[model samples]
Target: MLYYFSLCNILLLYLILISLTFLMLGFYFIMNGIIYFIEYELFMLNGSQVIMTLLFDWMSLIFMGFVLFISSLIIYYSSEYMSGDKYLDRFIILVLMFIFSMMFMIISPNLISILLGWDGLGLVSYCLVIYYQNIKSFNAGMITALSNRVGDSMLLMSIAWMFSYGSWNYFMYIDFFSFNFDVKIIGLLIVISAMTKSAQIPFSPWLPAAMAAPTPVSSLVHSSTLVTAGVYLLIRFNPLYLDSSLSLFMLFISLITMFMSGFCANYEFDLKKIIALSTLSQLGLMMSILSFGYIYLAYFHLLTHALFKALLFMCSGVVIHSFKDCQDIRYLGNLYIQMPLTCICFTISSLCLCGMPFLSGFYSKDLILELYSSCYINMFSYFLYYFSTGLSVSYSIRLIYYLIISDFSFYCYHSIYDEGWIMLKGMFIMVIVSIFGGSMLMWLLFPTPYLVIIPFYLKLMVLLICLFGGWLGYMINKFNLYDIMINLNYNNLCSYFGFMWFMPYITVKISYIYLLMGLKLNKSGDYGWFEMLGGQGLFYMLNDFSLKNQNIQNNIFNLFYIFISFWFILLFLM
Candidate 1:
């Protein structure tokens, strides 16, 4: 019945949405499918409306194009990749579910509807992650699924609070301010969920865990797909951020996530894990810029990052597929000779990622830095811009150096078999864009495309700063000179928060001494405090009550639970 209700709701949502769209959605999907076949780009700035009380904006449509583009690629790419796997039907079903959920998320008519799609994305992705359902992979997938559930819970509660406060006024973007509850409280909840989704700093472990999935799956998640959904959510809630005045808080968190993950990625051995961590860092950089209210720059970087990151992941997948499932970069070497096209594609993407001058990374990254520099009118904001700019360069350069120049000493040092033309063609197109699209974008942003533009040269100068910063990062990794490699002691993190990680050991040791003393005294029980007063006593009383009347116990239990929950909610609000 619940499934049927959800299905009816989803169908009802589509009916309302389809009625609003000028072009037929079915026809549009078919046309996108065909255009996907042609290897041609479409310049479409589409329309949207407030249907079913949800404000569907132009930005939502733009992001939807990205969602469809990547989902189509995943379907296109995985149809071949997962062809011989035994769970082929299951894979296709999960893919369809994922694609459907992504569409719902993009065009969701309400906060609740968007959240439903978010949960669906998490569910289907977890299934696809362990599609083979192997024990180790299943464990990883389950952990990530659990994390998503926690994030979902926070998001659901936040949306409920927002709606309850805003009531009917919650129908559109302008209605957020109509709510009576603390905007700061509401904003924190939204940002918390966003951080977990985007894999920011402390919550960053999930993406690496998600690498338990197939390479194609990882590619989609990294490149403007599900992992990005969180940042996109934050972007969507720009009104909330502006209301809460929490942009500085957001920028700080993003900057920390950016550099820290980058440093960590340097030490990782798994091919997918490295890319996944790099994606986290790069997305963090974009989110940090996004917090500055430069939405266009953030969106542009997202588009640029989508291209090179997906291309890199696809290329990496080919490499891993060849190694008979060995994913350690340490076990991969000198494949430029054997898989020339894949190597070229990977190199181009790596350079693009590094923000090398004249590359796609250069344009997107340079614009963000330009935006950052403009924020230097204020000293605090200037310091933030300075730190984040340095972090971006560090992480970007680290990824390139590890993939291209590091001495990983691959044990399986064999030539790669030539992949099919489908893979090669995708790589070919992506590399061209990675190299030259930066120049085109620079032209779009500046007058005379640089002929009448000294301001543009200043942009070039900022571009030089990024390149030099990346070069410094290359030297840092190339020298092997950091204690960052040996810093994985999680016990240290626990201790840094001033909790002794050895508390359990110390407690057990002291307990043993107490046990020896108690044995000497012939005392049997370790129970005390609440246990001595009403613990077993209360249980026995409950058991006696149950023996007297089971119905009475059930009613009492439900009554107190409801009363306490009501009081707690009141207290929390206060």
Candidate 2:
């Protein structure tokens, strides 16, 4: 029975998994620059064969190692965060499934095997997102599941599209396929699939909505597993689409996603949702960098992001749980005193998120910016890149102001403690990683690097933007700028920012209008007119004929005699 399964056991199991993963990781590191493949034939049809395959390379193994490490830490953190909850066992199982699915995705290079992991992620994530038996969780789950399903379907279609090539392993043809029209279509579909998975542009509403899940799920999904899956896939698929026009489209869409999420995070109030939006922003950053032909830089950022974002989520969980499950930032304050350890962890992660000098986020973010500046890009694109980078600082500072700097808005009499040692234990590991992971990964992954030649003014642009954004953030919160706008009859403008520039509204309106039209068409065309013209129409006509024929059957003998007599009389008269 679950009574026998305790939180301690879960942590112990995670510890075991962590040890094994580290062992494998060490082995893989020693074997770096080497590719190992294990394959076995599962079946054969005509000239085609189905095989089970696992590919072990530096990238895949390192990513898997990091994923396992973060997952184990998150599980350990959840021990405290989810303690006393009745459904803790189920939650643990869901987390395990999530981690396993991510591993499955990471190790497989075949499209067919990848789909197994892809769909598993979508299905398991839906279960996790709706873990709470509430209307909000249900709605969030529906949106999350439906949005991800679009990606899943696109992936499946792409798999079918690959049938012409007679192989499921995309790794083999990385540079073999020519950039023809058909190849472009497949590439386009794959990019769209990645966009949905990464929460780019129109697909972004689901990421914030998915904050309805428990903090652990949010940590896992937003950090190492679900959202990053798309970036990972694109990195692996990058060889095939290096020169495709679709990459240009992705570049713009990713920039927009980055800009939108960064600005929205500044306006958001819920602590978890703000963090979630930041994850979206970073995912966009990774995608945009990847689109710029910096796949390794993007991958480097993805790994570093997973480290700090997971820790950030875990810290937010502590704060939210301490505040009696209150998540609104408006009610949070003075955490630096009440929950010193948690606040410190949160601060480190927030600074890292802002790309503070020498932090984990700075390594990859700085390199990406310098490369972007040195590249021959237009003025508009450069502005979007720098502006979005600044917004990251803005939101990070805004979050810090509300949660740590201001006075506590919660009830004064309630006691708050920073005593969740288990949660803190998990966060402590990430604290080190958040500080050093970026630099370490940068050195390990890119032993040889390009010397980026950016102008001095552009080199200092990030610093200037951070300072300005930080000041704006402080002013906005310190003087109650949002309230001032409301008081001065700028409610419309405030609403737009608060509602993410009406993105959610647009998504809801489009979904509602189309759904209504579909229902009306079904009612009128399928159920009403079509049914009448097809099955019901035929049934009614046959039924009426049968009823009239029944009357004729009853009078058949009498009618025949009457007809014969009338014919005889007519003949005699003639």
Candidate 3:
């Protein structure tokens, strides 16, 4: 047993080393301006070929490197976090499978191979999400799996749709199919598929619900791997969306998702759920940026967000574990005094998330803001972007107040430990990256920086929003204004925000209501009408005839004589 546990750690360490080597190699290639693309046939079907293809430009390499790095850290951290569990080996295996699936998707340019990786991710994530074997975990896993299956089915449809072109490798014909109507159909399907995977708007509940998984899984899958797969797909399929109506549609949906999740996060009480909501919000930001044809900027933000968000989750895991699995922020307070290192990491991550200057998020977020300011967006888009920005700060401040500044509100007596060195060490790696990754990536990824001019007020827009949100969050959380508002005939409004702007209600109406109606129809029509008119009805009528003919069969000899007389009479009449 001990050997198995040690083996898990060893495997993670080996993967980390390999990933670091590849990361450095990728950087070398980038610095020297190299691109590697390869393809080979795996099989032949009806004179067509099934091929394995790889495309490694700066994008895939950097993205692959980041995915591997984060997965390794998560696996390393899980070693200690999951030490006493009976199924530790199983957990490690799942994590490794999830990582492999992500790597496969990253390297593949063939739509077939991408679907292979895509389905693999969805299946493995469901397993990981349901690892706890509780009702909540089971339901969450079902929701997560079913939600992603929507994307999987859409991807399959795209592959079949592409059959008309006689090839499943989208990269080969990306330029040729730019303005084709079929290409638009495929692009629309891809956009919806991405929406499902990224948990945009109507598909968003599964993301937060998936926090029922273990915290390590949350840190890994929710923060880095599963959620980002959609954005990565869009990065690969960027050509399909240029000047397309679907891009504008996606932009609006992404904006709504961004604002909705940010608003939901402020009302969220569960620590892991809050982090999950933040992930959803960041995904929205990525998708929104992608819709604008700034795929590189979106990718840049995706990478940086993965760094700090994973660290943030790891910090949340430490706090939850330390508090004996209590994740309610209302019960969590004075963590800065109790768990100093974890607190420090969490604070830094929160600051980065809020786009504080010079952090990893600062660089990417600053670029996004600059680009938004420079774009020819209408007033609605402008409001949504800046409003979402303020909401991000609002939630960050609200969380900090509840988790760090408030008095410790729990009744249980306990000693807070700065142990869990393994977890903290994993977090430290990301912390260093989160502190400087933005500046480094900005320098590396952008050869020529974007030039955008803005007025003084526009330049300080994010700052002003943050200030306003911080003040509002402080007043609501710290000074009891939320309590006063809740008591004074605003409970219904509070519930709406608390329930994520009625998204859950809307989802139930659309999803569950339809599901129930289908079941009812099946019961009444297929089972009721069809059963009566088809199988059971036929069986009952045949059985009644058989019973009526029982005497005739028993008197076969007499019936034979009667048949002879009838035949004689017929012959005479003829």
Candidate 4:
């Protein structure tokens, strides 16, 4: 009975969240949306099979708890940041819908339930991104939809393959404990889905485009909650990825994404955009580490990342809100003096981002490195981890340096004193947890003595690397990283890199090659090769007729046909 409640009670949480959001919108009648947090024992059900579960598991508890906290903070900050806007009605509806999808996603009992929530959130997030309905943001919004659809199709195929092992039952995940029956194919497809969602290589470019959203939006969904769904899915599938060739692939992609995004972060001048790029890098690092067999470490990083990242983004939003009309890092600085509390919050969180010692990220990120070195692992992966950590430290230092360096250049600073105290209060809550987050978290998870190993060496090394990154930035900015950009394109350059670069040229190139090959074949004699094999397609026709004439009548017999068709169509990627 209690197990069943998890699936159903989330609907109640949705109802209350939506109702309160609506009520708050009515009261404000501007752009404010309400946020509510409620907790109860939640049930999880998967059709007529594998119907009950209650999670005392450390991973599930930590993931869900962080999701709840960051989500609440984003909404609270949004109420003020979005004050006196025009899209209040529409924005609230989408926010409620987004929350609903996240809830459904976390509680999904079976892969099917998970997919439903996954796709629902995808659609809702696209709507939120295009809520402004301007010419350019909407187009960026469409690109996000297209890339996500391609990945979702892959996930759907993986689910179909899992069903094929026996039936459309997920309790049998335990039964799928090996790499037999072409499991790597589905595993690869699933990783494609995860990579896209987590904003990894090739697919990572969408996340910065998603920055067209409102600041609080970038804070909550993009930085904290939505993108993290990919990691959550990979973690959920730990049983399948436990020991396989597929895990190596996941690790490789993750390493590349981490280093690439870290380099790109230097070029991002927009505060929100820098954070967006950093989130992509950090998430890739987490997933790569997890794939290499550190489940607890992965979840720990995910949990800690959500808190500090949300805090940083929200604090950036506060900076933008106070500036009255500033958007770029150049137009804003000395924010430390102007918004001292916000600056303090941002600084602590920023250090956390660099994985400074005793901060939460330090413990989590270092443990994975510890595990990575424990065995004579892939030498390449081991070095990549070190390289990735250094870059992470670099960009984190970059955000603090230029952001505080020159002094506030705001044309008119509004002097925001935590206008939305509720949101500030929420962020402060995370900050408190974040400052002592390492100690408390370790205490909760491990025994007392072993928890004491997170140390000064890791902390000092990261901080020293960060200081060097800041020095490098001071020189790079003085010489100008792209002296050409500041001298020329400026805002246009921002639009070009941040938005235009991700257009699907690969898809177009593939299609062009396919068409060219067909044309060349027809010009020669190869076009008729199929005709020689089947003589005007009669071969498949005969097979079809013979199968139809057999007159299969059993329900189980027909079920396999439907199942196979679903899998084939799903696996049919160009």
Candidate 5:
């Protein structure tokens, strides 16, 4: 036990040291406007070089810093969370592998290298998701793996397409060949790949389903690493596709994803799933902003969201741990009475999610909304964006009410307490960053402030929507038997909204069809058709033929014996 504890501390220290180093380097690079690229040529084929490249831009370095920092804190928290688990060491190794995979993905400019990291993330995430070894975890892991495989396939196709360009280092030719047909195809493929990784629109269900993983993995994966890989990829490829029609398509898809996820989060009851849905909504916001060609703003929000979201998950983990693994929010009430520190951190993170004034989310979310308003988008998109923002606040307020404001809903006899010091230590660090990480990142990422010249009504719209949304959330929790009956009348509608508009069902059905096909193929190819036509069928045919020949020989022997007996009788009579 002590060895495991020491192992966690050592890992935590190393990750933190590396994170600080990366962060300092990132700051220096940003300050000096320096971009360094290091390349190692592995070999050449047909004059097309295959080189492993690492990019040391402010973006990659800072993102890496954030990833490692969050990873370190999560690891420390997990030391306490998974203290009793027998496979704690295995868990730690998997997490370290995940961190390394993320680092590789963050720094690599080569498509081939990116795929290696990308595939590693998908594979490791699958392993982590099924860590609990239950049916649900297994299902969740399968869904996570298969869904990500789509993105992997897309990325592989993009790599194959890029082979025509003589080098897979996309950074070298993306801008130069921005208007080329092959480049456009590669861009489209990359967009699809990013969509799958980021869980956009049709691909959104996996994010919430991935909640089957442990809370610490949840904090790390959902916050800054796995899900954000798609947005990061798009940000890297922003120069190539920002001017194309793909950006417009991405805009619509991202807004709908934002609206859908925010709406679903309100209807969700599971604590982790709610947080996961919120992550989905935030990812949509990032993708939407990226689609609008504001790359830095998207990146800024990504960093800030990572801080608060991780804190949110950490606090939820504490609550769930104290509740003896009860994740249904209805059973969790008055947590503030038992876990005051955790409740405080949870409330702060929830408010940050709501874009409350001066919070981390406010800086980035406000800027994104303001910049979105300033854009020349359609009114439909405008409505979706603001409405989605309101829904975010709605769900957040609803969660806070269920967890902290309401009376205790658990059993009469319960022993819920905030006892994990190491977990609290981790949450404490995140809380500080969740409060101030936004403004700090904002100033550093964008040295020049963006100018927005929107009307007063437009600016005031956000405040009004937030207030209205909060009121709606409070009302939602105040439902009586009458409201329940009224909702029952709209059961299908409620289920549709609650189930992420049946996106999971769609994914399941698609997978089910493939599984069914595979079953049929296995039966026909291996058992039915092949069995009849191959060795088994030949053996049966040969056995029957030999049996017939033996029967014929037996009949011939019987006839000869009859003749010999008849001849012997005749000879004796003579």
Candidate 6:
């Protein structure tokens, strides 16, 4: 175990080194405006070449840097968080594998290589999600894996469709065939793939369900590896189908997803699940903005979001760990007193999530809202965007209230402290980044500012909406007369919204019905009819027949003995 701990430290150092290298390289690429595309031909069939392509741009490199940086911190944190686990080495290796797969996906512009990485993510995530070896973990892993498989299938269909264009490198064709019907289909497929991976709408339940994973895994997966892949893919493919019906469709879906996740987060009690829902909400924001043709904005938000969100998850992990793995927010309170450092980081990240001014999230989130105000979109889209932003603020405040301001609700005997130096060390770097990452990334990603000529009211709308959201969040948690009355009157409605508008029921319940049918089929066919009429039935029949035959033989032998005795008696009489 000591050796594994040392190994984790070594891996963490190496990842940090690599991350720094990538970050520097990304900066260099951005400054020089350079993109390097390297292709290695694997084979040729009938003049059609199959090759592995790598795209090294500022975007990919910067994204990779962030992914590795967070992954390194997560691994370091896990060394402390999972120190007692016997399979620490296995966990470390799985995390490294996940990072490698993410890097693979990040650099690949080719559909085939993307699929390789995409499928790798799904497979490893399932492993990580089910790491705890419980029925809940198993269920969560199943839902997660199956949900991703839907995206995988969509990507596969896109690949098949792209094969008609004679190249798997979608970047080469997206511009020339932007309006082609086949290209449109491919774009649609990619959008659906993105939706599934990002956990939009029907796929939303899996994100929260995946909370069964260890907190460290959740921190990494929810922040970067699993959930962000879809957003990244959309950013890459945005030029192909932007402003079409597909983008409109994506806009609607993402808005709904954003609204749903934010609303659900407000009602959520679990610490990690709330963060997961927030991640979902952010992904929706990213997707929606990307759909509006603000690719750089979406990418910018993705990077900044990754930094703070990872920190947020890590802080939640600390709280959960100190609380003896008690994740229910209702049972947690006054953490600011028990774990000041963790709470500080938690508060910063939470505020960042709420788009608090000057925080990492504020730069990207505020810009997104301002851009939305400037766009010539419909009233529904307009309302949903601002409403979702408010919801985001509302949930962030609600969560902070529950965790920090509320009175301690746990037992008096409980001992909760921030004693994990290594965990704190891991989070320390993130604290710095979460504080200033947004401004840095905003400047780095967008050298020229976007000129927004919006009305004064529209410019102030974001702040006003945020203020309203904060007020609502606090009041909702206050349990005042109005709140109680509303809850009593709208019990079912609250339950519906709290449950992600019954998305879990739609995904889990529907799949559960099918699973039940499968179980019945197994019982009635494999165990029932097959056992009764096939091998087991034949064996039982043969065994029964043999037993009866033995009985008959015994009876015949007894009768013969009787006849012999009678004959012997008759002979004696003669």
Per-model TM-score versus the true fold: 0.70, 0.92, 0.93, 0.73, 0.92, 0.89
Candidate that beats the other on TM-score, 3 or 6, i.e. the better one: 3
Q: Give the clashing pairs for model 5.
A: none
- Measured by TM-score, the strongest candidate is 3
User: Model 1: what TM-score?
Assistant: 0.70
lDDT of 4 by residue, 1-574 (tens): 2322342235335544654454333334222333222324345456433433222233443455556556655655565567667655456567767877876776564676678878997898898888777976886687677668877898898887776566433444556456766566766787788888887777876787787788877777754468988888887777667687777778888888887777777776778878888898888888887777766667667777877888888888887776664668878677666567887888899888887778877877766655555545666876676676777777776677766766666666356455656457757877897878676666555543333243566535445655676567566665666666767858566444544243345533544687788798885544476665645567778877878766654365787889999999889952
Cα displacement (Å) at residue 342, model 6: 1.0
Go through the candidates in order and give the C-alpha RMSD of each one to the true structure: 14.7, 2.6, 2.7, 15.7, 4.6, 6.7
| Candidate 2 clash figure, as a count | 0
lDDT of 1 by residue, 11-70 (tens): 434533543352244234433532211111234346523233333444555456555555
Whose lDDT is higher: candidate 2's or candidate 6's? 6
Better of 1 and 3 by TM-score: 3
Q: Which stretches of candidate 3 lie above 4 Å from their native place?
A: 521-554, 564-574
Q: lDDT by residue for model 6 over 1-574, one digit each (tens)? A: 6786798789888999999999999999999999999988899999977778999999999899999999999998999999999888889889989999999999998898999999999999999999999999999999999899999999999988876687888678667764878878888899999899999987989999999999999999978888999999988888766868998888889999999898888877888889999999999999888888998898888888888899999999999888888999989888888899998998899899999999999999999999989888999889998998999898898888888899999998987888999999989899999998888887887788888888999999999999999999998898642357466797787688778888787888888898899999999999999999999999999999999999988799788999999999999999
Instruction: TM-score winner between 2 and 4, please give it.
Output: 2
Q: Model 4: residues >4 Å from true position, as ranges? A: 1-58, 168-171, 378-380, 412-423, 448-467, 484-574
Cα lDDT for residue 179, model 1? 43
Give each model's clash number.
0, 0, 0, 4, 0, 0
After TM-score superposition, the amount by which residue 35's alpha carbon in candidate 4 deviates from its true location, in angstroms, is 30
Q: What would the TM-score be for candidate 6 when compared with the true structure? A: 0.89
Query: Arrange candidates by lDDT, highest first: which order?
Result: 5, 6, 2, 3, 4, 1
Kindly list the per-residue Cα lDDT of model 5 for residues 400-470, writing each as its tens digit: 99988887899999898889999999999999989988888878878888888999998988788888888
lDDT, model 3: 0.86
